[model samples]
Target: MADALLEFRGVNTYYGDLHVLKNVDYSIGRGEIVCLLGGNASGKSTTMKTIMGVVRPQSGQVLYDGQEIADLATSERVKRGIAPVLEARRLFPRMTVYENLEIGAYTRKKGPEFDQDLERVYQLFPRVKERRTQISGTLSGGEQQMVAIGRALMSRPKLICMDEPSMGLSPLFVEQVFDIIQEINKQGVTIFMVEQNASMALSIAHRAYVLQTGVVVLSGPAAEMKENEMIKQAYLGEMQVEAA
Candidate 1:
């Protein structure tokens, strides 16, 4: 963890009288794919929000590149090389695909670098390029997901925090999206994802943490977690039942 890109040290977060995150500690090393796994009502989404500065921790530290960012604004966090692919693919419904992508770079000035980044996004999602002029709301679910990811990449992030990348999509699209996530990670951007699709997330993640209520119950290498009996019963087995 010497080269940790993001770290949470004994972090605790609350919403009014309710405690959402309880002394959580997480360290995401540079160039790694880390996933957070949990069921409904767990603190999974809260963790992502805490990192993005959407929610402030009541105590403990949130550090990025060794700098404290708990008090930073969301825009400042994005400016510091952290971008989020928020839950549910929140795209501007009235805007064209290209315009939605343009919004992603709001923190950066439009320049030659922006153009190059746009081309990179296009290369990653050719379908997005084809639909650049089309309204984002009109695109299919799979295509929308692609554009959501493309928009995140347009920020040129060092760490991409994704909340449920496989939330709603056909099986084919889910597979494609996960494949694209791996491809992006291979290009050296660290990924911290919160996913309900346990099997798919674990398959691609280097490490994973399991949250229950407001506490981390289990965490370790993804391979070992996949083989864990508790994990199988709690997550993978449930997935199989749904598939059945």
Candidate 2:
């Protein structure tokens, strides 16, 4: 995986005495969208935390752009071009959309490039720009998700880790959210997402890893996974009957 932008090699993480991630290994190449899929309590969110440095692995490596960063601080990771669109769109409720987005650039100094990135986010999320002066807490759920994604883009990150981007959204919004994710990947930002919606995730993913009880049970190209009998039965709610 010499061309990979992010690599998790033999990563084993624990929560207290609980072994959360066991020898997890995966990679996301530059300009690709990779999804981690699993059911409830399957360590999908823990994988995202490990990458973001919020939860440290007991052993192994997290390499970003060929450099090891498992020991780096969370803020240090952000400075090195990792941004997260956390679950549930954790925006500053009392703050205006404009102010919330500006806070995302706190790791970088104010300058022309930073402002240009803000404009870039606005262009990507026109609804955000329209609601820039509005209170973030007051926007619709879908609009708030857009602002959360816009905030992540404001950081000008090389990689964006999204945790359950479609969670808590209506069917229409879920479709729209997936569309936006594909658009963002087309714009050249690598995406590593943790999702429970396997069908939606695989539709836009270049590759995907299926985690079961903290271990990777399946990994392959998205198109292949879509037709996999095990995946269809387990995640996509499809029934397959064997011929007698």
Candidate 3:
């Protein structure tokens, strides 16, 4: 049966009394690729952190699979099928690529299933197979990003939230990153990402939300949002073409 896989209702958050996210209400349907769009400090990252339980919301409800999960711990949230790829590319610098991914699945039920998880991660990043023993710190920026993403997928979560996955990459690599996001979504992994690459986000996302200083100023189908006047004026720098 269809259901709202994740929901944030009237959520409010504060960083030491400085309000960050204000009454944010959003939801992601099962298997949907939704992009959260905003400039820096627009509460995009805060939203992801709040959902992942890294930052507790000062108010409002966070629901996952119809259960209120606002009170859960970070590890508990991961066990409940919510995994996040942070913008910081937080991989263990001294660890081998395989070791890093293995760590991501540390909370899983003990069994042969853990090995199976490694196989799944290798499938997504075949280069990971070639560099399984290499230290993540020595890898290039793009490779580090891959490790971060691969690690998140190691949990085999139903939803993956990536914060600015394309930041700090060469122009050539940016296209490759977007393709990877698309490929993952095609494999039926729901994605909720915060991306500053406006054009790429709108083109790839199935739907998107535009946040302005902790408020959702625009949201709709990806195609429609791509053409939105505010989005074009601010991000695209051109009006969207009408259907001919």
Q: Which wins on TM-score, candidate 2 or candidate 3?
A: 2
Write out the backbone clash pairs for model 2.
none
Which lDDT tens digits does candidate 2 get at residues 175-237?
988998898889889999998778889999999999999999999999999999889988777
Error of model 2, residue 65, in angstroms: 0.9
lDDT digits (tens) for residues 177-199 of candidate 3: 78888888888888999987788
Please give, for residues 209-237, the per-residue lDDT of candidate 1 as tens digits: 99999898899999999999999999999
Q: Which parts of model 2 are misplaced by more than 4 Å?
A: 238-244
**Clash-forming residue pairs, model 3:** none
RMSD of each: 1.0, 3.5, 3.6
The stretch of ten residues in a row with the least summed lDDT in candidate 2 is 235-244
Scored against the true structure, residue 244 in model 3 reaches a CA lDDT of: 15
- Which residue runs of candidate 1 sit more than 4 Å off their true CA positions? none
Whose lDDT is greatest here? 1
| Alpha-carbon RMSD, candidate 2 | 3.5
Prediction 2 global C-alpha lDDT: 0.89
By lDDT, the better pick of 2 and 3 is 2
TM-score of 1: 0.97
